[model samples]
Target: MPAEKPSHFGASARRLVGRLAPYRMYIAISVALTIGGVVLSTLGPKILGRATDYVFAGLIGRNLPAGATVEEVVAGLRAQGKDTFADLVAGTPYLVPGQGIDFDALARVIMQVLALYLVAALLMWISVRLVNRISMWTVRDLRSDAEDQVHRLPLSYFDKQPRGEVLSRVTNDLDNVQQVLQQTFGQLLSAAVTVVAILAMMLWISPVLTIIAVLTIPVSVLVTVLIASRSQKLFKAQWAHTGTLNGQVEEAFTGHELVRVFGRREQVTARMREVNEELFDVTWRAQFISGVIMPAMFFIGNLGYVLVAVVGGLRVATGTLSLGSVQAFIQYSRQFTQPVTQVASMANQLQSGVASAERVFELLDEEPQVPDPVDTPPVSASRGRVEFEDVTFSYGPEPLIEDLSLVAEPGQTVAIVGPTGAGKTTLVNLIMRFYELDAGRITLDGRDITSMTRHDLRERIGMVLQDAWTFEGSIRDNIAYGRPGATDAEVHAAAQAAYVDRFVQHLPGGYDTVLDDEGSTVSVGEKQLITIARAFISQPSLLILDEATSSVDTRTELLVQEAMARLRTDRTSFVIAHRLSTIRDADLILVMEQGRIVEQGTHTGLLAAGGAYARLHAAQFRGAAVQVDAEKQAGEVPGAPG
Candidate 1:
C-alpha cells in the first residue's frame, strides 16, 4: 500500500489551534489567570532574596564596632587587605555596625513572599480546572462534527474505506486528541509564561548573567527539533498501523465462520500478528525517540545553571551586584531552566496530537456528496411509474451499464434475471440512486429523480435485500424499523402476512424478544421472514426484492412468494431473481447480460420463443424433467419423498 499521507506540521498545528476559536472567551480567562499566577510566582525569589540579605547583615553587624559609619566599615575591612569582603559588606544595606538583624523587616518580606505564592497557586489551580472544562467541550463538538461528516460523505467513500479504520480515526484518534489538549494545554501555557517572566527578571538583575544562563538554549532547541522530526513520522505510522490492525481484527472476527469452514484460522492469525507486530514496532520507536528529548534538555539546562551560579557569585564578591540580587539571579536561573525543560518534553506529546489532528482533519476535509437541491420540483402522486431512459453508469473506467432503458409501469412486477456480474443488482441500485448515472436520466412519474430530493425519492421505495440485517432490538422493533411510527397492530399484521407470526409464536418473547446485533439467536430463514415483514409494513408505492426469498426452505419460499404476490398487487415491483422458478409468474421477465437487456417477455412466452430465458429455465429444471420421466415409468409422483 502507498504510504499514509504525511501531515504538514505547521498546517496541522494551525488547524488544531483553530478548533479553540469557539471557546476563545474561556481560553482567554485561562490564559489571563495563568499569566497572573506565573508573574506572582516569579516574584517570590526576588522578594525572598531580600530576607537573605537582612539575615546575613545582622549576623556580621553585631561583631563590628558600635555606631560605625558605612564608609568606616568598608575602610576598616580594606585596611586589613580584605578588599572583596569589604566590597560585599559595603554593597549590603548598611545597618548600624553593632546592631543585630532586623527581625521585623525579615518577617515582613517572608510574609509577602508567602502571600504571593499562595495567591499564585490559587489562580493556577482555577485556570487548570477551566482549561479542562474547555477541552471537554471542544472535543465533544469535534466528535459531533466527525459524526455528521461521516453521514454526509458519499456512499462511494465507504466503498473504498474500511469500516474499522474509519471507526478508529473517529474514535481512537479523537480520544488521543482530547487527552493531549486536556493534559498539555494548561501546563504548556504556564510553562511558557514562566519562561518569559523569569527571563525578564534575570535580565533586570544582570544582563551578563542572564546571557550566561541562556547560552545552552540553542543546543536544547536543536535536540528537540531533531528528535521531534523523526518521532513525528513514527507517531504517524504508529496510528496508521493501529487503524490497520483494528481493521484486520474486525475482518477476521466478522468472517470467522467462513475462515473456520475453509480451515484458514492459521492464515488469519498470522495476518493479525503481522499487523500487531508492525503496530508494536512503530509505537516503540516513536516512544523511544520522543523519550530522548527530556534527558537531553535536562543536561543542557544543568550546564546553563552551573555557568549562571559561578558568574553570579563572582559578581556579588566584586561588589557589582548586591548579595540579595545574586541570590535572586541564581533562583531565576533555576526557574528558567525548569520551564525550558517542561516545554521541550511537551513538544513530543504535541507531535502525537498533531498526528491525530491530521487524521481528523482528513475526515473533515472529505468531499461530501453533491448537495440536495434547495428548490425541489414537486413529484407527482405515487403511481410507482419508474423509467430509466438510456441510463449509463460505471463504477470505474469501463461502463457497467451502457444505454440501458427499461420501464416498469404502475403495479407491474418486473423480474430481472441474469448471470453473476451481469449488472443484475446494479440495475436496482441505479433506480435507488446509490450511484449517479454517468450519461442518462432516471425518472419517477415523469419527474427526473435528480430534480426531487433523494429522501423523497427513496421514501416511495421499500427494499428487502438478500442479507436480512437486524440490529439489537426487540422483534417488534426490528419489524417497525421499516416504518418507525407504525402502530403495533400494523406490525403484527405485516408479520402475519409474511408468515413471521408462525415461528414468532414459538419464540419466548414473540415480538418483544431482544435479539443480538447479528440476530444470531434466530435461524437464517426466520431472519428473512422478519425482514420481509419489515418491508411489508412499510407499505411503499414501489417494492424491491433482491433475492429476498433465497434463504428459506422450499415451503417457506412458496409461502413468502404468496405473501409477496399479495403485497405486489397494486405496486410497481422489481425482483432480482436467482432461482429462476420464483419469478416465473412475474408480469415481465428481463434477461440481462453484460450491461444490456438481451431478452424481455412473459416466462411461458419467452421459454416457447427459445431465447436466453428458455436456456435459463432449462438449466434450472433439467433434473425435474428427468425425475418426471422416470416417475412416469415407476408409477409414482415425481417430487414425492421416498
Candidate 2:
C-alpha cells in the first residue's frame, strides 16, 4: 500500500533538525558564536549609557562653580530663586558641579562600544559560515537518501506514484529545505538569545519598565500562533499543488507527440492552468497570512516601547532612575522589538520548510521493497532451467496466477501467446521477480530464487522491454551498458549479432555516434535494434524478450530473427510472441486467459488439437505483426505489457 501523506510541523521539523545531529560539533560552535555575538552587542547600549552619563554630568557640572559639590550647587541655586533647576541638579547623579564634558572618559567609552560592535559583527559572520556548512552537509545526505530510496523502491511503488511528483520531492522540496536552513537557522538561534538577553538588561535598568516591556509578549505569541497555524496548511497545499503541476508538465512532455496526434493540446493546457491557478492562490495566501506575523509583532512591540519610554522619562525626572539608564532602556527597547519582529517574520519561512520537510519525510517513510536477504546461497554456473511451483500473486485483492506451476528445461524456447489481459506479459515479470509471489515459489537451476540474492538471480538474465529506452551517450556506450567494460571486439560482435552493425555503418559516426536520451537521432526501429544489441551483450544464461522486434519492418525483423536464432542457441528464452513466426519457432506455446494457462503444446500439435492456441494462431497474420483487438478476440496476445 502507498504510504499516507505526512502531517506538517512538529514531527517533520524534529526529523529535519535531527539531521543536524551528525554535525553537532559544528552546530555547537556556531551556537556558541551566535550567543557571544548577541551578548556582546547587548552590552553596547549599556556601555553607551555610561557615555551619556558623562555628557549629562558635565553639562550640569558646568553650570556651577568648578569645584563645588552637587548639594552646594543646588543650595546656592535654591537661594538664588531657581528652585526647579536646583532640584534638577540635585536629581542628576555623577554631576561634577561647575565642570565641563569629560572628553577623556567619553572617548574611552565610545571606543569600547565600537570595539564591541565590531567583534559582534565578526562573530556573526563566522556563525553564518558554519551554518552554511551544516546545511550543505545535511541537504547532501537528504538528496542521497532520496535517490537511494527511489532505487530500492518496488515497481509497485512507482505504479501508484507519478514520476513527476517523485521528481519534485527529490528536487524542489530538498532545495526548499536548504534555503530555509540557510536563511533561518542561525538567525532563529540569535534572535531567541537576543530576546532573552534584552529582557534581562531591561530588568536590571528598571524592574517596573521591564514589567511593562514584557506585557506585550503574550500578544505577540498569540499572533504568531494564530497565523502559523493557518499558514502552515497553506504552505503544505502549495507544495502539493507544485507537485501536481510538475506531474502535469512531465506528462505533457512525455506524451508530446501523442497529445498532438490525438489533438489534446488544449486539454493538457487547461489542466495545467487549473493546477497552476491553485498553486498561485495557495502560495499567495500563505505568504499573506504568514506576513501578518511580523507586522502584528511590530505593532505590539511599538506599544510596549512607547509605554516604557513614557514611564522611564518620568522616573528619570523624579530622580528614581538616571537619564543614562533611561537612554539605555530606550536603546534596548528598539533592539528588543527588532529581534521579536524578525523572529515572527521567520515563522513563514519555517512553515514552508516544514511543509517541504514532511513531503520528504513521507517519501523516506514509505515501506521499501522487501529488504534483500542477509545471506544468499552461492550457485555454480546457471543452466537456464526455471520452475514455478504453485506460484500465486495479484496486483490487488483478487488472486492472479494462483496455484500455477510450470517449468522450462535448459535450452528450450517458451513462447507465451494469449489475448489482452490473459497474463501473457506476466511470464517475464514472474521470471524476473518484478512482483513477488503470494504463494509457492520459483527456482533457477533448482535453487529457490528467493534464496538467491535478487542481484545474483537477475545477473544471469537479460531482458528487452516493449518500450525502447536510451540514454544520452554514444551508441557504443549504450550497448556497453548491458555489460560494463566490454572489450571493443566483444561490443562489435554483439552489435553484429543483433544487426545493429548494419545500420551503424551508414551513420556519420557509426558505432561512435552519440544519441540523446530519447535517441531521436535514430529511427524507432533502429533504436529497438540497439536495445537488442544491449541484451545480447549481457550474455545471460536466460533471455526474456517482450516484443523485442515489434517495431522493425519485415526486412529488419527477418534479419533479427536470424540473429535471434543464433543468439537462442544453447540458451533458454521466453518470448512474448506478437507475430505468428515467433510462435511457430517456439518449442512450447502457452495459451493463458485470466492468469491460467488454457492450453500448452507445440505449434503443429496445437494446430492439430485445435484448442485455444489454434484460435490465437489462426487470428495472427502469417509472418506479420498481429492486429491488436483482433488478436485479443482470437486470443493471439494483444498488448505489450501484462
Q: Say which candidate scores most in lDDT.
A: 1
lDDT, candidate 2, at 341: 86
Q: What residue pairs are clashing in model 1?
A: none
Question: What tens-digit string does per-residue lDDT give for candidate 1 at 122-146?
Answer: 9999999999998889889889999
Candidate 2 regions exceeding 4 Å error are 1-3, 6-8, 75-94, 622-642
Error of 1 at 65 (Å): 3.3
lDDT, residue 321, candidate 1: 83
Summing lDDT over every window of 10 consecutive residues in candidate 1, give the lowest-scoring window. 633-642
lDDT of 2 by residue, 1-642 (tens): 365575658888999999999999999999999999999999999999989988998887886788777878878988999876776677776688778899999999999999999999999999999999999999999999999999888888998989999999999999999999999988888898899899899999989988888888888888899999999999999998899899999999999999999999999999988999999999999999999898899889989989988999888776678789999999898888788788899999999998998999889888788777776657789999989899888878998677888899999999987767777777679788887888899989998887777888899999988789899999999999999999989899999999999989999998899999999999999999999999999999999989888999999898998998788888899998767676587888887778888788899999899676666565554324445556666654434433
C-alpha lDDT of all candidate models, in order: 0.88, 0.87
Q: After superposition, how far is residue 24 of candidate 2 from its true place, in Å?
A: 0.4
Candidate 2 lowest-lDDT run of ten: 619-628
